[model samples]
Structures are given as C-alpha cells and as structure tokens.
Target chain A: MRRREALLHIGSWMVTGAAALSAGRARAARAAPLDQPSVRATIDNLFPDLPIDTSDAVAIEGPEITDDGAHVPVRLRLGTQRDTPHRIALVASANPHPLVATLDLGERFSGPLALRIKLARSQSVILLAATGQRLYAATTFLKIVASGCNPGQDETPPTDLGTIRFRHDPPREGMADARLLIRHPMRVEQRDASDIVSRPANHITMINVDIDGNPLLGMACGQSVAADPYLAFRLRTPQAGETLEIGWRDTQGRGGDARFPLGI
Target chain B: MSLDRRDALKAGAALALSSLLPACATPLRTPPTGRVVVVGAGWGGATTARYLRRWAPSVEVTVVEPARAFVSCPQSNLVLSGGRNLASLTLDYGRWAADNGIRLVRDTVRDIDPERRRVQLAGGGQLEYDRLVLSPGVDFDYAAVPGLEGEAAQARVPHAWKAGPQTAALRARLEAMPDGGVFVMTIPAAPYRCPPGPYERASLVATYLARHKPRAKLIVLDANPDIISKKGLFRAAWRELYPTLIEYRPSNAVLQVDTDRLTVRSEFEDLRADVLNVIPPQRAGDIARRAGALGEGERWARVNFIDYRAERVDGIHVIGDATLSTPAPKSGHVANQQGKVLAAALADHFAGRDPYRDPVLSNTCYSFVSNDEAFNVAAVYRVAEGGKGLRLADGSSGVSQARSSEEAALARAWATNIWSDMLG
Candidate 1:
C-alpha cells in the first residue's frame, strides 16, 4: 500500500515539472519580439554622423506583396525642385544592418533612380532621405515571407573586384539605356538561419562612369546594396558608337575598370 | 519536517521515471540502416550525397565517379578568361569523405542492377545498396550535330564541355590562333548547361583577343536569333568593349563539319575555321539509360516531387541535371536544394516518422556578362498536391529587371553565397 502511494506521488511531480519547463520556453520566446528595437538600433549605428532629416521627397517603390524574397525589385527615388534636396539615401531597417544604399545627385536633373535591396526579415523599412541641409525620412512595412539568408544557396565568395556587365537596350535614336552589372558578394554580416555568421562586409564603395572622358555619374555606396550590384542609370547623350568607360571601387579599396563602346 | 523529506524523495523519483518513460515510449527508432549508392560527383550528385550523410547519419553513402576531382561548371568561364586557375575551381572528395563519413568510390560505374540493388564497377567490383541516387550530370548528344563524329573532333575541335582538361585545351587553341584567324563557336539551342555560359565565354575570349591578338576575331554561330539569359547585356558588352573583334550570327545552325578540310557547313553557307567549338545538344547522363532510370523521352529521369524518388523505379532517387523537375533549372543551386529535400525524406523514412509534407525547393542561377558584370534569376518550387509533380509556387521566383546595377550586384552576391553554401 505504501509503494502504491509513493508511485502516485511521483506521477504528480512529473506532470508539474513538464508544465514548468514548457512555461519557461514560452516566456523566453515571447520576450524577444520580431519588432524589437534592436533593428532600429542597428540602423542608427550604421549612419551616426550623416546629417539626416525626414522628408516626403524620397519615394520607395517595391511590390506590395513579394512572391520571392530572394530577388525583390526595390526602387528608391528622390523628388527635387531647383531649390529642393540634392541627395537621397535609402535604408532598409529590417536588414541586418539596415543601410542598403546611398545615392548623391550632383547637379543632375529629372527622372527617378532605382535599385534592388535585400531584407533580413519582414518589417518596416525606414528610408532616410537627406537634402544638402535637412533630412527627410519615411517608413514602409514590407511583409517578407521568405528569406535569402540561407547560406546553403550561396556558397562562393564573390571576387573582391566587382563584375562589370554592360547591356545595350535597343537604342532609340540618340539615347540608349546602358546597364552596368558589377559582381560583388555584398554580404551584410548577419547570423543566418543555421546560426552561421555571415562573412565580413563586402560592397562596392564607389562607381564612376565616363563617356569619352566626361563624368556621367559617380556615387558612394554601403552594404545595403544587394549581391552582384546592378547599376542601371540612363546616359543622356549615348551615341551610336561611343566608348563608355566604367570603373568601380570596393570597400577594401580594390578597383576594376572596363570600357564598352555604345552600339545602336 | 517529515512531510518535506517525503516530498523531496518523491520529486527525485519522478524526474528519473519521466526520463525513462520517453525512452520506452519512443523506442529510439533505429535509423534506417542501408547503403545509399550515389553515381556521379558533380554539383547535383555531390550535394545530394553530402546532405544524405549529414541528415541521415545511419545511411551509408558511397559516391562513384570516374574523375579524380571536380571542377565547377559555374565558374569555368572565368578560367577561360584567365581570371582563375583550374586548381581554384577543383575540389577533392577526400574532405567530403573523411569529414562527412561518405565513402568515395573512385571508379566508373559499368552497370546498375536495380533488381539486385547493386552496381557493377568497371574493374569487376560490385556495391550493393538499398537506395540509389544517380546525378550523372549531362551527356552530349553527338548525333544531333552531323559530321562532328568521334576521333578527329575530339582531337582537333574540342567541345570543352566537361570543364577540366578540355577547358584548358580550348583556352590553348584560342591562345594559339594566328593574329587574323577566326575562332568559331556554335551555340546550341535551348536546354543547354548554363544559358549565359556561351555568351560569357565569347565575352572573355574576345577580351583576350582584344589584348593579345588584335587582328583575331570571334564568330558566334547561334542556333537561336537571340542568345539565352543575358543576351541584351552581352550584346551591349560586345558592341561597347570589343566591337571590332566579335561578330554574332544568330539563326545559323551547323549542319555538318568537315574535319579534313577544316570547314563547317551551315544551313546557309559553308565556312572555314581555324578552330571550332561544337557545343552539341545535351541530355541526361548515359548511365540513366543503362540503369532503366530515364523517363519517356530519354531526356531526363522521371522522379516523384515529394521525395525525389524515381517515378518508374523503386528504391532509386535522381536529382540535379539528370532529373526532370518542372520550374527548376538544371542548376547547381536547384540540385543542392533537391538533395536536402531527398535527405530529409530519407531521414524520416528511417526514423519511422512521417516526412514533412510537400517539400519546397529553391534555385538561383547567376550569369556573368563579363568579369565585373553579372545577373541572376531566382525561383522557389513545391510539390503539387496528389503527387502529380512539382510546380513553381504561386508567389515565388522572378528575374531581375533588364538592367539595374543594384540587381546585377545582388545576382553576383547570390552566386558567391551559393558557392559557399555548397562547398565551403
């Protein structure tokens, strides 16, 4: 009779232990919300000294719902008047480091600039646009269902020097869209799903295009640039057969140059 | 004091009994015990075998490949341009074998015995296994291209499709051509390895010719009017960078080759070439036919999407370039994902647990227009319900816009990360 009583007592103890263990796990999971301030803190740390102000001049265009997060088309445009902002910088707050790209419009006019950015998880992406004096900011919440952070898909380290690809869109009269693609891993240091730390940060720091020795565009960049950075900006005076010289510099100070002649 | 002492003893006893109850209830399912024989060690085969060893530790994995080492086809274009060496691209199976406990059988598989679950090696040895994975890469359909027969073409006109010594041979031939000699390369129709590969090769070879042999030229005889993948990008690079040295002739197909006369006859005209690279149409590896693993058309192996097991045969799974997976290109990235899926299914089967339902697969292909320029197309796929086949998920997969610098950079990063994920 005593042994039977002891068995019943032990059974009750086991049930209590299991319940406590599950409760602890639930509490731990609830403690770290996905929308924690850590993401915002990361953005603040990426650009500490830049003179940034919030404005409605910058517009971030992306799919309302992305089917695949691996490659999402993200376009950032800065609105300006003769007396408005001269530069625009785009930041993806949900990304590991949050800063995707920063573009400076140096006395250029008309049209919008677009590029792709990678998101770490689905969250509100903060776009901070800075004028010559003040900075304007906007936030858009993007629902990312999938992540490209799985390193299993990405095995090779991109070469230090970026790949340069030039594509000629069927030229129409005097203007043609020149697409220059550079190969860089652009890995933002972040822990992946497998708990593996990503490689050190590598991104194209600057890109310059010269049409027959005349500077068309030059700009600085950050890690928010997606892998194999594609820079597609139009050239105003692209002739049927003029040489377009392109050069790029990476964060490591390595540089590469390629020249392609314009063809109609 | 007496009640507290009794309660402490009861708690200790309960903790020990609960730990014992799980062992008795679950009965550590003996991991499925069997040898998994994998034929071929290319991207698909290698990744499948690697993942099998990782996910299903109880299964013995053996890889049978003829080559001593593997050179990645994804990066071979850089080698032709002299950007990277063959060694940099080469990988030994030792690390994969020792670290992962995979058995590397360095021999050619002469025949596969599906009924006996055994494989006969070239040297009269046989390996018995419960499951077989055949990812034999790609085989050239020589009959597709007339007059390009054996012996002479293999000796003089190199295909350089296999990516090792043949790659070196083609590079040498290009380097040795006379200052004004023409280097003719024929691009196959669709469904070839690496759609952007031929164009990238042309771009790099042109880059070499521009610097080394100024008078030399590259003539591309393409089967299609426009090159696949990044044709627009390549055309821009070609016209802008090496306009004088490169000429593209689209909608031209090679009908015959005259080795003795050193000439190629197209449907339109007969052209003489100092060197020739006839990239013939490709199909699934030859072993799939002998093993009775091929589908109806003999082009690719038919496999069930949920588990990647052969649809026609039992106890066999085929992945990579050899398998006919809808919406997934015959890319290394896709193959690796398929490998993981197969591994997961096998692991569950061994544990006597129901495998996760409707496995999802993903892939991304990055193509370089030049050393510095790259683009990519990415997609995600899942098995259709009722076990019919695989389909691209409604909201997954896309190609980057025609020419965005940011998209191009992302494509390059995707390629690098893919390489690291696979081999690193």
Candidate 2:
C-alpha cells in the first residue's frame, strides 16, 4: 500500500510540471505585435504601387530589448548580390511617423548601412530591401523598457549652444573623419507634460556636404534624428589641404555653413 | 655568501620587526598615474577635468579650450527679459585649472591621434596623453534653410543659438526695434540642444514686449505642430501674463528667411518681422566626426556607459553634446554629471583599483516661465546592461505635476543651485 501511494505522489508531480511547461510555451507563442496597424498603413501608403516582397534577404538588427528608445542604433543589411541592391528602406512602425529613414544605394554601395532611428514606444521594426525588381524583407521586434520619445521630465531648456570645435578621427594618411557641433534645445512635438495641447515638431531638415566646391552628399532629415545629431560618413578619396564645406537647414528656414580644411 | 652567527641573529630580528609593522607596510599607497586630455571646457569637460584631478592627483590633466571665457547656456535665457547681463553668466576656467593643477592650454584641437594617444593642436603642438575627453558642443546645418547664411546671420538675422556675443547681439536687435515692431522666433524640429530653450526665449521676449512695447507682439513660428517641452506651463503663463504680446502658431514651417526684406517665408504664408531669431537645426560637434566617433548617419558619438568611452574606439572618451546618450536629454546638468562619473572611472583605472560600479547621477533643469514662476524637471540615472545605456531610477526624476506656487519658487532655487554646481 505504501509503495502504491508513493508512485501516485510522483505521478501528480510530473503532471503539474507538464502543465507549467505548456503554459510557458503558450505565453511565448502569443508574441506581441511589433508593428501597429497605423504604422503598417503608412508604410503601404508610402510605396503604394510597388509590390513589396517580404523575404529574409533584408534584416533589421536591433536589440530584443532596448533601455532607451530615443536614439536606438539600427543597422539595415541587404543580401550580398553580384550587383548592388536597387533600393533599401527602413520603416519604424511605432514612431510618430512610420518612415524613419530611406536609402537608395544608387548602384554604388554594397556594405550594410547603419543609422539611428527614434522610437516613440517599444515596437517591432521592418527592413524592406529591393534588388533587381525583387523586394525582400525581415522584421525584428524591440522591447523598449524605457521611452525615449517623451523626454518625460528630462526636458531642460538649454541656455547655451556652447563652444563649437572640430576633431578628426583616425588621423591617418588617406583617411579622415569629421563631426560638426551645435547647441539648441531639440524639442520633439509629441510631449504634452505642460498641459499645452500638442506641441509642434521643430527639427533640422536638410544637410549638405560639399568637398572642394563639389557636392559629396545631400540629405533631408526630420525629428527622428536625435538631439545634437552627429552625422558621420567615410570619404573615399580624402586629400590633404582640400576644403570641406558643410551646411545645414532647419524647418524654420534658418541655417549655417562652415568650411574646414582637410588635413589628410 | 655565508652569514656569521651575529649577522644571522640581526637578520632574524629585522624580519620579526617587519612582520610587526604590517599596518605601516600596507602596500605603499602608490596613487595611480596617467594623463587625461580634455577638449572643450563647457560644463561637461570642465566638471570631468576637475573631478579627474580631484580623484587622481598624480594623474596629469590638460584641457584644450579655445574660448577664453565660459558663458553658461543654463541661465542665459534671462538675458532676453533683461533679468541678467552676459557678464553675470560668463565664467573663467583659470581658477579650475590653476588651483586644481590641471594644465589649461588655450588652443584649438586640430586632430586626435587615437593610435599614438596624442592630440595635435591648431598651433602645431602635439600633446601626448593616455586618455582623451571630448566635450565640444554642436554645429549648425545651414543648408536646411534656404537664403540663410553667414552674412544673413550677422547683419539681417540672428540664431543666437550659441549664447555669448551672439546672444547679446540678438538681445540688442530686439531692443532696438520700434515699439510696434514684430519679434519673430522660429522653433526648430526635434533633437536639438535644450528642448525648452526656444520656448523660453520666446516667453522672455514676450515678457519684454508686455511691459515696454505692448503693441510689439512676439510671433513663434514652429516647424512641428506642438511645442517641445513645458508646453502647458508656457501656454498658461503666456495666456495669463502676456496674452496680447505673444502669438504661437504651430506647424508654420519657415521655408526661408529673406534678411533684406526682414521677412520669414513659411510653407503656407510669409510674415514680416523687425527682429528674426531664427534658431537653426544643429548637429554634433565637429571633433567627433574628425575622430570617427559616430556611426554612419549618426550625428552623435556612441559611448559605453561604464566609462563614457567611445564604443567605436578603445582609448577615447566622448562626453557632453557629442555622445549619443539616449534617455538623457542634452543638457548641461547631464553633461556635468557624466564628467564626474567618467573622472571616477579614470581614477580607478590608473590606480589598478576595481572601478566603482553602478554610478547614480542626478539632473534637474528649471525653465523660468515668468519672473515669479518657473517649471522644473529632475531625474536620477543608473547604468543598465544589454548594449542599452542609462535608465532613470523610479520616483527619482519627475516634472512638477501641477506647477504649484511653491514649485515655481523651488524652480528658481534649483536654477541657482545648478549654476553654483557648474561654475563654483
């Protein structure tokens, strides 16, 4: 009788363990949606006519969990092909605006394009890649434990733009790196802590880089860029004593330009 | 070598005495030694350099600053309302360097030799150091706005974004305008320095108009549909204090500024103003890019919270306006706190001591809504893992929920405290 009772007890324990395991699996299966419907609609509306082929060729690399959502490091990689990919775009479904960044390779670049994206809340991001009329894509959901969208209580009206200076990275022969600095209170439009209705978005919209009177790169940016945006890119042919001109424009129609001599 | 009986007895006696004096022999306190070269002498760089010297006296510290004086951005907003003079806000770094034994070099940094651990000054002097600290502030992107350039900024318009002579120039322009003249201040999009700064300037300008020139209305043309920070407080204060003097129009994107005609052209309409405070969009300090600190299309440096070191490079530390520190707004308070934390970490490294773990930092920013009232926000941060950065401690950082009468008074007090902390 005692042996029979012990067997029954062991059997009950096994049954309970199996039940907990199944419960955990069920929770994992019910993964939260990464992209909201509104964000998906925006993505679709932006590219209405094109047939977006959702495939694994394009991957969005982001942390499964992010501590700060304001400036998340997002890397978009396209599949290695015999030729360069035709079009690559990045869309953050959870941001106030769906399209965070868009890049057209223009038949020249091949390596992965890395940029930072702003997240209003924790949401999944999708990377869409097009190669030779074929669209391939992948998605990664980032669980943002902290919200970067609403500075919440961290907003301080900056009193100083501070001192401006230029420094080059890897001061080597043939290769040079540079960054431009400015100071302003970069206020996003979505915060409502002051009980004011919705705040308007004020951000830098355009950046133009000219080397020796020739335009090297031009871009149109939005609030998705972090405060004190630090734009960096590689110059394939850096020659010493050449002049590098940079200019920036804000939505307010106010801008400034600086000329720095390249010390290659 | 053989020792005689007498000599052996003496040696044994000496060894016994050494064992007894264990406390005196406790590992010679060899304070760690190193060199830290800091670029830019703003709140971030200044505090970091100061703390580094205080924490590690043996470490040689040098700060490269081109500016002879440091005028704080925190309290400069009061200048628009005629509350303070530029001289009151300006600071000198001579005391910090001389008294603290930090080598203050007044020279522009041309380039950073990360490999050789040296910095090339603009004057052709190469200074070698083990660690480099960069806190150079932001730069403006002029091409974003058409018809706004160098001559336009100097003669016709003023961004006054960098507080100093330009800030004084802007105030002079506003005061010189006629009583009924229009004061136009354009707000940039997100991710600029001081989120509420533009609004504060607008409020101060409106205040000026309310008392001296009631007919001279302040028009705030913002790019976004909403104000960035303290919108409720600002709107409430404006409505109550200077209702007729201030008009805020959201989403009125200024396409360009015609300095000659004194008109700001927006996407929807064109408005004429006597004074145009066109705050332009901005980017990271140029030094970060020169040092290859930022990622592709990244306008800020990627830094590790452990030591505020650049994630891309090993021996370089990037702080202040250049780092891409999310969750923490780009404010002088945050920069100063980061400098202190980095100083402690550097000291630990030099002394062969285990670095202090999990530093807690605090930041509080006060925006004066009126001469009598101000809005305040404060937070405490801690480093978290998983490639993610700092996280705010619960119940540590928050905004004044209702803008209580007492809270406004406290805000002013906080402002005074911050200035003292940064400069004093």
Candidate 3:
C-alpha cells in the first residue's frame, strides 16, 4: 500500500484516472485502494489467501469530519443481500494503533450496528466486512482539529474510574449477545517517553468476561477504543447453575466487576 | 474595567471588508430569496432567524429545535448563587415563533443529507432547505468521569452545565445540604462553553455557601493547569470574599467517580462529598457532529469564520458553543454576533454577491464575581492569514482591570438586551 503501489493499483481499476487525477489528489485519496500501507499489510497478513472485493453495498456511516477524535460515532451497514457477512472489522488508517475493533456477528445478529471509536489523528476510517471469501470496504476521511490519543496502552490510575454497565439479550436458540459499557478515557501516552507534558492516556487495556462460573473471553484494547468503551460479543446461553459475570482492567491497573444472575 | 482595552486591542490589526455594502458590490442587486433551515433556537439560532427576517425578508426560514424553552447559560450560575431565579433565565420561544414569520418546527434534526439539502427530523419527515444553520449547543463527554452519566447518574452528581431542570435539581440539592456538609464541583479542561464560566460558577457557589451554609466548605477541582479566564479578578474575589470556605485545586483531573460512595478519584488524591457536581468534558451536540461539520480530534464544529459554514458541508453553517471558534471564547455575545454576521453573509450571497473573506467579529463577556460586582473581557477576532478561520485581533482582548457594581449591572443588562434581540 505504498503511495507508488496505490497509484499503480488505481491505474488498474476504480474510477477513470483522468477523473480522479482531475480531482486534485482525489486519485490518491478516494480512488486508491489501500491508501494506508500498514492497515493494508495487516489485512493482507490476516487473510492473505482470501480475495477482497470492493462493494458499494457496504457503507461506513459517520461524520465526514469530527472535532473530537476520542469518540467518533459510526454505524456499520450491510446490504440486504443473500449470504451477508458473518464478521466485521474497522480500522482507522491514521490511528496510532489501527484495527479499532473486530466483532463476530453471531447467529440472529442483524442489521446496521452502531459504534463510537477513538481516532489518533485525521484520516480515512475504513470499515471492512467479511462474507464468504470476499472483503467489502467503505471508507470516509475525517479532518481532526486538535489531536488526542489513546496510544496502544492505558495507564489511568484506579480511582473512581467511571462505572460498568451491560445489556444482555435473552437467550434465543441458545445464543445471546452481550454489550459491555466499560467507562475509561482510553488515553494514549506519547511514544516518546521524554515528553514533559503528560497527555493523559487513560484508556482501558483488558476486559475479562466470565459466564456461568466459566471464563468466557477477554479483549485486549488499543487506543482506538472509545471513551467509556462500549463493546459487543456473543456467548452461549447459560444453562443450569450458570452465572454470568464481567470484569475489566484499565491501563492504570484499575478494575471493576459485575454479575448478571441466571434467568428464571 | 474599561471598554478602552477592547478598543486598544484592535489597534493596527488588518481588518478586511468590515464595511461592504451589498449594493456597491452589485449595482443590479437581485433580491435575496431562498429557504434557510436553522437548528437549535438558543441565542445563536434564534438571533440568526430574527435577523434574517429583518435583513432579508424574502429568504424563507424554518428553525428546528427540540426544546420548547430557551435557557440562558450566561446567567444560570446566578440561579445557583440566588442572585436570579430559574424562571428569569428560562424564556419561552412562543413569542419568537409568533413574530419572526419563521416556521418553527418543534423537532430534533436526526440526520442531514448534505447532497440532497434535506434534514431528516427525529419524529419523522424531512425539511429541505437551500442552506442549513446549525446552532445545537454542546453535549457532555463522560468517559473521563465514569459511572456519573445518563439520567440516573446525573440525578446523583448534577453537572448543571446546561440550564434547565438540571440547574434546578442542583439548586434543590444545595438547599437541602446541611450547614457542615462538604460540596464539591469539578471543572473540565478549556475549549468548553465559556472561558471564565467554571470560575464564575465557583465564585457564585462560594458566595451562596458562605452566606447560608456558613460552616460548610466548597472544593473547586479544576482540571486545567491554571484558571482559564478572568484569572486575576476571580483570584482576587476568591481571596477577598470567601477565602475560608472555597479551596481552589488546580491541575487535578478526576480519574473516576463512585456514585455508590459519593467519592471522586483523581491523581494523587480522593475526595468524598455530600454533594458532588462533576462537569465532565464536552463535544459538539450529537446531531451537529453527525452533520460532519466538526473536525476530528476536537469536540466542536469547525467552520469558515467568514460565514460560519461547516468546512465539510457546502451550505451548512455552525455557530454557538458547539463551534471550535478559538481565539474567540464560547460566549453568548460571540454566538449572537456570529449569527448576525452569518445572516448578512447569506443574504449577500443569495443576492449574487460574495461575502467578505475576512470579516471581523467581536465578543464581549461580562462575568459576575458576586451579586453586585462583576468583571468583563472583550476582544475582536479577524480572519487569519489566507482566510483561515479567525485569530484574536492582536492585543485586542483583555480582562477588566477591576470588578465593580457597575459592571454587574451591565452584566444583567447584557442578558436583557441579548434576550430581546433573540426573542423580541
């Protein structure tokens, strides 16, 4: 996804080079696939064998620009087509640590899902949906005013660090979706350790999910997680003697736990 | 103390196109005519609507606002201090709707279709316009202070930043406080609604607690490194007025909040209070940000200073506190002036003439240090190099040299004049 490679890729496909070139950097920006080298490399590394197809049916719906990079609201919409995607992933090209989120759309999962994610700087936010063997992408550029960060780690001190709330769907066909709202600034400290002014990188680092006295899963978040992070995942419907609990630890090593009792 | 500070600040600043007669620009002036959609009926949106009616009658206008009443943020702190009642700060928009010949739609703009020039309403249906003016105020960012958001959380720790039931709720909670109880309030970083606002609130609350709850103490937890606005005056007033009761803590960022225990956790310390007022960070209103007007990394809308148009969208303009109009404090006076200037700019543009690229706008903010004494600051912002937004007219802004009763009266008068201009 180097600039030269992107230009060559643009020459092979997409809108006419003349029209894109006439747009004045439009070819490099809008028309070029994989404008971001690292993001493209990551995707290629993840699914090197899978073919990625560009589709207009996939849309990254959010503001064209936002004043705050900490919590940019976006919605992932998939076309009402047969064999819809089973997984969705979002990446911010300019984010310090891309790969904002990777979610599995489990059985009974449906429609456009809403999200609020953090961005390190101004850049195109790429949304990729994987269905069958192809990856569909939709991107929109955001211009940031004052930059904020949640680098790759969080170091927020464990003090009244917000609260944790959750919403769990009633079991349908032995599967339920759980949305966890963990409150944290998800601040990203500057990579340069010698910087004087401490830009508070108070982001959440780890979340542990325990259901029915068994460990469910864990998420290792980066700077791309929004403030007061809201995350969704799927879990098996609790059976006899099952207890559901969730816990999270922020970068500052502060943590909280919550329990959802069994359904009668 | 003197208006001369403002007058002196603008000396030798290059202010281009301060006087541009539409007639002179175009001899054959086509009467301006087009539909203008305005969202939020606060001082900024309301003033734009009224002025458009006055200056450009033919331009059809419709304002979309969810709230039925206009709450004045400028004086809500007075309500906390008992200098004014909530009723005085709240004004009904009925008169504005009745007199302005503008269609007032009582609805929220859920989405904006920039290409289609249409705004989808929350309840349903769409309002199409040739131009859209967004003045939705600010929305609180509560990630930094967790477990203290939403209705249930707000019920416990009332920010009272917005003027309405929250303000009344905080007042009632304060009134119910025991004389020996501890009241704590936290201020977020800068680029918030008003520069000197948190201090004004701190000052007003200090005055109230000292008089009624004499034995009680108030803690001012400020996240910023220093007092942001009118520092000298606020510092002096705090030292002279309620030195014992008010403890000003600077650079103290509230890391977390535990509502169950009513405690605030910050770096190096933890404070428990009977009444906690946490003013969390804020960003542009949800709908305004959805319009893609605000830039990334910042929380307010970025606009062309000349016309207040959103940089991302062609015919949409954003004003008020939700805008990132730096070098210009987010005050009522600045928003109102931006509205008038934008109104004229749109009028002239519709008349087939270009709006000046680098127009000048001024802001005069008066903050009450007490019920009788106040301090004021004023400045003019001109378009920066290459018409890039605005910068303070060099040396043109200053905080008042002193606080006085006359300035306090002027502060009250300022509210009446601005209210009339928006609603009369």
Candidate 4:
C-alpha cells in the first residue's frame, strides 16, 4: 500500500513538470511580441490594426549552421490546422537590409516555401504569417561563418557580361519555386571599371514577378545584395500551360527578363 | 583499374586458343594469307597492325594514315590545363612498322569501292585490299548547334574535341583569361570520345586557376542532366576542393552560340564567356558513312560482333568510334581490345578456320579530379549474339570508390602501358 502511494506521487510530479515546461515555452514565444513598439510601428506602417496570436502557430525552417551568408535557404510553414492563409512576411532581423520578402498568397497557393535569402550576421529570423482571423510570428536562430553579400568590390563585368539564366524546381499544389541568376558584376559602389560616379547604383534595384499577365510580387533592394545577383523565391503557380516571367531592372534602367512554362 | 601485364598475356593466350575451326569449315593449321589494309592508324588501327603481324605473319599488312605520327586523345586534357605536355602524347610508328614489316602510307583514304576492292586516296592514289579495317574516330556534328560552321568561326569558338593544334589553342586562351574572369566550357551529349574528358578538363583547369589566377571561376555546362561518368568522384572534388571556383550546370544544353558576343545560349539561359570551348555532338567519321558502311541514314555504323563487319557488307570491318558498340563506351582501350580480337579472328579466317565463338573486351577510363589526384571507372564487356556489339559483363564494371593520389599514378602507368602496346 505504501509503494502504491509513492507511485501516485511520482505521476503527479511528472504531470506538474510538463505543465510548467509548457508555460515557460509559451512565455518565451510571447516575450518578443509583434506589439513591441518598433515591431508594431513597422507592422502598422505596412499593415494596420492586426491582432497577433503570440502563439507557436508559425515555424521558420532553415539550416542551423551555415558556412555561407550570401545564399542561405529559408522556409516558413503555417502551424495552424485550418486552411485559409492569406499572406506572410519575413524579416532578417540582423541584416543591413532587414526586409527580406513579403509573400502574398491566395486561395490557390499551397505547400511549404523554399527561398534563398541573405543574412548579414548570425541572428534570429522572425516570420509573421497571416491566416483568416489571427496573426502568427515565429523565430529561428542561425549561425553564419562565411559572409556572402559583399565578397569583393568591382566584381562587376564578369568575363561575359549580361548573361541571364533561370531554373524552376518541381512545384506542388499551386505554388512554384524558381531561381534566376544574372551575370552582372552588380556594381553597387562607384567602382572604376563600372565607370559610374557616386550614388550611381548599377546593381539590380527592382525585381517583378508575374504569371500569365497577372501581377504578383514586386521587390526593391539596395547595393548590399551579392554579386551575380542570384535571386530565388516561391510564388503562386501559374495557370496550367501558362508562362511565368521574372523581370528585373537595375538602377541604370538596364533590364532583362526570363520566362518558363508552368505545365510541363 | 586496367588489366596488368600478366592479365593481358592471359587474354592474348585465350585469343590465340580461339583460332580453332568452326563447324562447316575446312581444317588447315597455318599462318594467315592474303592482304589486310587498315585505315586511320589510331589505337584501333595500331593494335590491329601489331597483332596481325604477330598472329598472321604470312599476311601482308599495310596502314594508310594521313597524320605523321599518332597523337593520343587520352591524356590531351592534361595538356590543356598544363598538367602534361603534347610531346608526351605524340608517338612515332617507325619502329613498330619496320619491325612488323607493315607499309605505312601517309595518305588519306577518300572512298572505298567494295566491288572493285580498291580505295581512292586524297593524294590521287589507289590501294587494293582483300580486307579493309576502318578505325576512323568520331567527327563533330556541327549542325546540332549554330554559329560555328566555317573555319574562321571554328578558330574563334574552338571545339578542341580532337587532340591537335586546337587543344593547344584552347590552353593558350585559358592562360590569357583575366585573373578574376569566368571561363565556360559546354559538354555535348554523351557517346562522345572519352566520357570523362570534359570533367577532367574542368578539374585540371580549376587546379590551374586556383594556383595562378585566384578568384577565377570555371562553369561546366553539361547538356545531360548530371555528370556522365565517374560522377561520385567528380562531385566530391567539386564540393570539397573547388566549392567556390567551379559552377556545374547540367541539363542546360547549348542551343545557339554568339561568337561575336561571346555568349552561349542554352535552353533556359544565356551565358557570357571570356573563353568558350564548344564540344559539339558527334557521329561516325565521314568516310565510313560515305562508304555505306553506316547504312543509308544512320548515325553510327552497325557491326557483327563475330568480325565487326559492317552489316550487309563484305570484306570491310568497322571498329572503334565508328561502330555502335552499345554497353561498351567508345574508348581507346575498348578499341584496342577490338583490334586484338579481330586480329585473332582474321588469322583463323585466312587459315581456313573459324573465328572465336565467345569474346570478352574491357576498358578502363581514368579521370583526373585535380593535377595530382584521380579516379577511375573500369568495365568489362562480353560479345553477345544477334549483333548487339558488346554487353557489359556483370560484376566486372564499377567506378572508383574515391579520388586520391594513388589513382593518379596508376593513370600515368596505364597510359604508358596502353601507348606502348599500340605504338612501341
């Protein structure tokens, strides 16, 4: 009878420990709330009057250890069980340029996303995903060893300048993943070979994504981006047999575009 | 791995034993007779000449070739990247020809008249032959890609597929590229000479750039979806040794070339190049095709494994890169083995006996991942019936498990042995 009583006591202590662990995790997730003044301000500037869940309903997936900072693969998944996910935004909290990307998905888009983003330093990347009724934010820590964004100066004018290439990965549901690499020196500064004076950014400044005449996302970046300007992202899957075109224009108005078929 | 000297001797013995007579044949044990004329004088032709001299001394042998001496394509990649010299690859045939009593004609065979049993030469000459052996190597299929048709264009955008002046020219171009420049080399579809040649060139060039021109990048654009040969070893070298210096893009077959702009346009992208080496698609050498040995509309000549005779043709045998020998790659080693096997068969044929009922062939391809490190893929083949050429013999083929300095030394020794077997 005494042994039975001891067994009951052990079971109760185990349940209590699990409860405390859950509460501790919940507090950590909520400690850096989206409602923080700076985060709230940025949020209000882009999207206003949105209540945040401050729960573990969003997860950031990526490598825990990275050797190259220029090309790190990152992805975000909605943790909520229900279906309707409208949009999501990612912030590289440590990057010189913090606004990584803002993805706008409709009812047609699905599947986990895969993308290559720049991380200036070792830090946590935060994500805020929006569903029908609530907002979710999650953070994942990453360690960077080799810096990528700025390998060298005057890396422009590659041996064969002005070459453009595109590749598309296998897509699932209504979401497609793609990559585009342009052989431009991405002359960010007023380097001599580029022949541009101060503040004349030859680096690609704007990238526009479209599918079958429908506009999707437009990105604006600065000189901190890497050379060769490799860009990869996920977007709404184009209509079957439709054409998906990714076009980019530099600050100097030198622009080009590449297109791929959606169906095959 | 290659067959050691002892294994080669064993194979020679088996080939000799195979000279026994077949059913429905007369029994006559004597040296071979009549005349045998071989064209091209490459690994295939040289081996055939040597073995014919040894196995059938009664037969008169003649080799008709345009080149002054034999220049090997096996180690030419090293020459391109400064790992070796062209002189090391150049070999003379004076000793071998004199010792074998084989007449060497420095003239190109233009056409073959099977009915008349004569060959027209480019130098306005003709040679009669009781049997003809053709080992003409591959010719580039230039129409597959655009902007490299004329001689001037070829000079500007060199293929360098054949080992000669073009190989040296490509090496010079690579040496002249800027310190931080990008060099792009595109690979043609498979079935080209030396399946690992392009990757070997890429690796050795990577080595050169890493030492002399730091920050330079090499981009290997492959028409196929992945590395065609010695894939694991090549990938390890790319990942560990040259993670930053090399960029491999496969399934990006070049569709057009802009020589003036120095651009390689593939199915999905346009790549700019400081130096462009365009290895184009390949087909059987032209003389074999024109002689109707490859049929009316065929890319490769079909052959019977019994004698390598072109289908539906008499007194003509096609070997080496010209024949569609499936499962076995178009390699010099395989061609050499074919030459030896055919030598024994011809000895029996002329001696009023039968050819070998079953034959086996082997090829070993060594690829240098760096100047001092290499890997190899060795395959053995069995001649199956119904004219399928040689089938890859199970359990006798595989790639090297790793790349190391040992394989590099073995590769050097292998090249020396094979060259001696053919030219010495």
| Candidate with best lDDT | 3
Candidate with better TM-score, 2 vs 3: 2
Q: Residue A248 in model 1: shift from native, Å?
A: 49
Q: How many backbone clashes does candidate 4 have?
A: 1
lDDT score for candidate 1 against the true structure: 0.64
Q: Kindly list the per-residue Cα lDDT of model 4 for residues B331-397, writing each as its tens digit.
A: 8998998998888888888888988868888888888877789988887788875555566687787
lDDT of each: 0.64, 0.66, 0.71, 0.71
Give the fraction of native contacts in model 2: 0.00
**Which CAPRI quality tier does the interface of model 3 achieve?**
incorrect
Clashes of each: 47, 63, 29, 1
Model 2, span A1-264: residue lDDT tens = 332243233233322322233223223323432234533443353344565666666677864444456656666666764634554445555555444544444332344554556777766677766566666667787666556666444456445432223334444444444444444334556546673437566665555566787655444454566555443333444667877776766655667777777763
Q: Each candidate's DockQ score against the native complex?
A: 0.01, 0.03, 0.03, 0.09
TM-score of 3: 0.60
Q: Place model 1 in a CAPRI quality band.
A: incorrect
Candidate closer to the true structure by DockQ (higher is better), 1 or 3: 3
Q: Native-contact fraction for each model? A: 0.00, 0.00, 0.00, 0.21
Order the candidates by TM-score, highest first.
2, 4, 3, 1
Candidate 4 residues lying further than 4 Å off, grouped into runs, are: A1-264, B1-32
